[model samples]
Structure formats: C-alpha cells, structure tokens
Target: METVEFYNGNKMPVVGLGTFRVENNDDCKEAVKHAIINGYRSIDTAMIYDNESKVGEGIAEGLAEAGIARNELFITSKLWLADYGRENVQAAYETSLKKLGLDYLDLYLMHWPGLDEAVMIDTWQGMEDLYKDDKVKNIGVSNFTVSHLEALLAQVSIKPVINQVEFHPYLVQDELRRYLEVQNIVAESWSPLMNAQILDDEVVKAVAEEVGKTPAQVIIRWNIENNVVVIPKSITPSRIDENLDVFNFSLTTAQIEKLNALNEDKRIGPNPDEFSGQ
Candidate 1:
C-alpha cells in the first residue's frame, strides 16, 4: 500500500476501510478482519459510528490470523461533537481507547469543528496534550474549512497533520486543497465515491471503460492521482478487495482532466461551517 507521510514523519496508508454506517457489530467485525487479511493497513472509524468495540474485536482477530503486529496497522477514530470541551477530551480518548482494546491510536481527529471557536481550541489543546504525551501517534481534524483551520491554527501549538473532508470529482474543493497543500496538511477523502452516487456518472463510466476497470476503481484512482487519501467504505468482501486493487493502473493526463472537469462543487455531506453538531 502507498502512504502519505505526515510532516511529523509518520505514514498512513492512502487506501483504507471506512466504517461509517456499518452498525451491525458482526458484519463490521467481519469486514475489518477481511480487509486486514486482504492487505489493508489502515482502518478508519469514529465515536459517532458506534462500532469501536467490534472494530477492536476484528482487529485482534485479523492480527492473529494475518500474522501482523498491532503496530503494523494504522487505526484512526474521531472525537465526537459531544466531547468537545478540554475536560471531556481526555475521558473521550480513553473511552475510545479502552473500547478499541488498544493502548494508543495511530491517529486521532477532532471529528468536526462544531460552532464555538473557544470550544474548538479547548478540544484541540486536549488533542495536543495527547500527542505530546505519546498517547497518539498523530492528530488531525475532519470537516474543517480554511476559515476554521485558520482560527484553530492561530491558537494551536501543534499543527494538524491532516484535514479530512468530503472529497470527490464533483466536490473538488479546489481552494481548500490549495490551502492545505500550502500548509503541508494532507487531505483525506471521506465518502470518496460520494456514497456511490458518482459511480454511474457519464465521465466516470467512460473513464472506467477506457481503463477496463470498474467505475469504482476509476474514481478511486482519480483520488489517488490527486494525492488524496481515500477511504471507500464497504461491507462486502469482494468490494473491499476490489477497492484496494487500484494501485496498478495510472490514469492518463487527459483522463485525469476529464475527471477534474466534472467538479461542480457539489457536496454529499454536511457543510462544516453550518453543521454545529446537528
């Protein structure tokens, strides 16, 4: 698996399994285990997803079966909106850690920017504490815009290594991407397939046909070429394996342009500015 290195010199797999709405414990566990056994090295989940224990179970089973150590994988989880205060942050991290059956996390992110600047700063300070104390290998944020990031940056002692957001051909977020590159922050794509809505678009389909790969593969490759870390969610074993089968092919310049041209600034997820923990 290819990795994108953080400014801190830590590496994360560019492709990983996302467990967002996979609420069924049994199914979620199986999918995680299957992903690891199939060569995946990163796994993303969040407190809001409510499946950390099952993910932990799958992690243990997968590690034992795959003969890989715990440190060989990159596991990520987020601090939910309800856990936004400085005081709440430590307990939240510990709760997530205990539930996941792990001593430390590879990456921990503030799930959303929420509505209050003071609260966001307080929450981030807590995350900075975690990083300084060696409780987590890296720290980042999700659903953060340039304005939100600027505000946070003004008060933070440790800069976020990543800003994970909804990214795809339609919602290219060109300005934000440029800003992140300037700030040396990695961009991670949540809902990279736009929840499967973009799979059948004419341009995506055409590219898939030309490359002789599935539409899903075409979109994943598009994200890869754009230097975005994509975590495409899937509970099906075959889809999980197929999602990782994107490293071999490279999209041509014209093909990449066609995909980039599909950008309509469309967003399938909530706007970070207005979300306010809704």
Candidate 2:
C-alpha cells in the first residue's frame, strides 16, 4: 500500500478499512482483527459509533494474533458533536484514547462542523491544544464543505490536515477536491463504495465487467487512481478480501473519465451543510 503525508509529517496508508455500523461489540472486534490479519494497517473509527472500546480490543487481539506492532498501524478516531467545546473536546479525546487503548492517535478529526461560531472556535481550540501537546499526529475535519472550511480557517491557527467526506462515483466532489488540494489537505473518503444509488447503474456493471472486478472494486480503484484515500467497510470475509483487490490493477484514463461523468452531485449520505448550518 502507498502512503500519504500530513503537514505534520505523519504517514497514513492510502487505503484503510472502515468500521462504520459495525454491530455487535464482539463482531466488530472480530472484523477488525480479521482485517488486520488480512493485511490492513489503517483503521477508521469514531466515538459516536459507541464502538471505540470494542475496536481497541479487536486491534489488541489482531496485533497479538498477527504479531503486528502498535506503531505499524494507523488508528483514527473522531470527536463527536456533543463534545464540541474546548474543555469537552479535550475530555472527549482523553476518553477516546482510553477506549482505544492508545497513547496517541494517528489522526483525530472533528466529527462535524459546529452549528455556530462559539462551538466551532471551541472545537478548533481543543484540536489545537491536542496538536500542541503532540497527542494527535494529525488534526482534521469531516463533512466540511468549502464554506465550512473557510469559516474554521479564519479563526484557527492550525489548518486541518485532512477532510473526510462522502466521495464516490455518483457523488464526485470536484470543487471540494480542488479546494482541498489548493489548501494542501488530503481528502479522505467515507461511504466510498456503499453508494446504493449506483449499485444497479449500467455503467458500474460495465466497468466491473471490463476490469473483471465488482462494481465496488471499480469504484474503489477509481478513488485510488484519483489520489483519494479510500476507507471501505465490510463485515464479510469474502467481501473484505474483494475490496482489497484494487492493488493489483489500474484504471485507464478513459475509464476514469466515464466514471467521473457519473457524478450528478448526488449524495448517498446527508449533506451536513444544510442541516448543520454550515
């Protein structure tokens, strides 16, 4: 797997295994453990998922089972909206660290942009404090649009190193990607392969046929080819194994253009900008 560098000089894998809606504490742990044993080093989790502790336990189990060292893995966690203030942000991170059973996180992100200026400022401060303390290797945001990022940029001293968002063929965020590239922020993808809208699209099947891979793999390879870090989630072993098969093939430029044309600014997930007051 390839790696991307954060402004702080942290190395993160280009592809990661996502743990979203990973139900049943034991089951979630097992998936994570198996994913690691299968060759995944980057794992994404969030405090709001209420599975941090389980994920930590799974990681511990996987490390012991596979003899993978702690430093060899890249662990990421997020601060929830309830913990948006300065004090609460720090407190939340401490709790997350405890749940994750780690001394420091590879990446710590704001789960969502605050509803107002006060909360946003407080959250930024909390992140800044963590960055200053060297507890979070990389500080970033999720579900942030260009305007949302600009708002935070005006007040915060340290710019976010990354922005995790819903990115896939049907929801290509061209404008956002360009803006982030200009800002030198790596764009991390979520819900990258779970786009229900495109699962039945003829283009997906066509691309899948040409590559002799699933529509999911085609979309994921599209992500990797476009320089986006993909975090695809799956609980089944075969599906997990299938998702990692992107490393063996490359998409041609024409095929990429065809996939890019599938975007209609349609999002399979919620647009926080409208409801979150971004």
Candidate with top TM-score is: 1
Task: Give lDDT tens digits, candidate 2, residues 34-87.
Answer: 888988889999998888998998899989998979989999999888778888
Clashing residue pairs in candidate 2 (N, C-alpha, C atoms within 3 angstroms): none
- State TM-scores per candidate: 0.99, 0.96
Error of 1 at 44 (Å): 0.4
Give candidate 2 regions above 4 Å deviation: 195-197, 276-278
Model 1 Cα lDDT, one tens digit per residue, 1-278: 89999999999999999999998489999999999999999999999899999999999999999999999999999999999988888899999999999999999999999989999999999999888989899999999999999998888889999999999999999999999999999999999999999998998999999999999999999888998999999999999999999989999999999999999999888988899876
RMSD of 2: 1.7
Cα error, candidate 1, residue 64 (Å): 0.7
Q: What TM-score would you give candidate 2 relative to the actual structure? A: 0.96
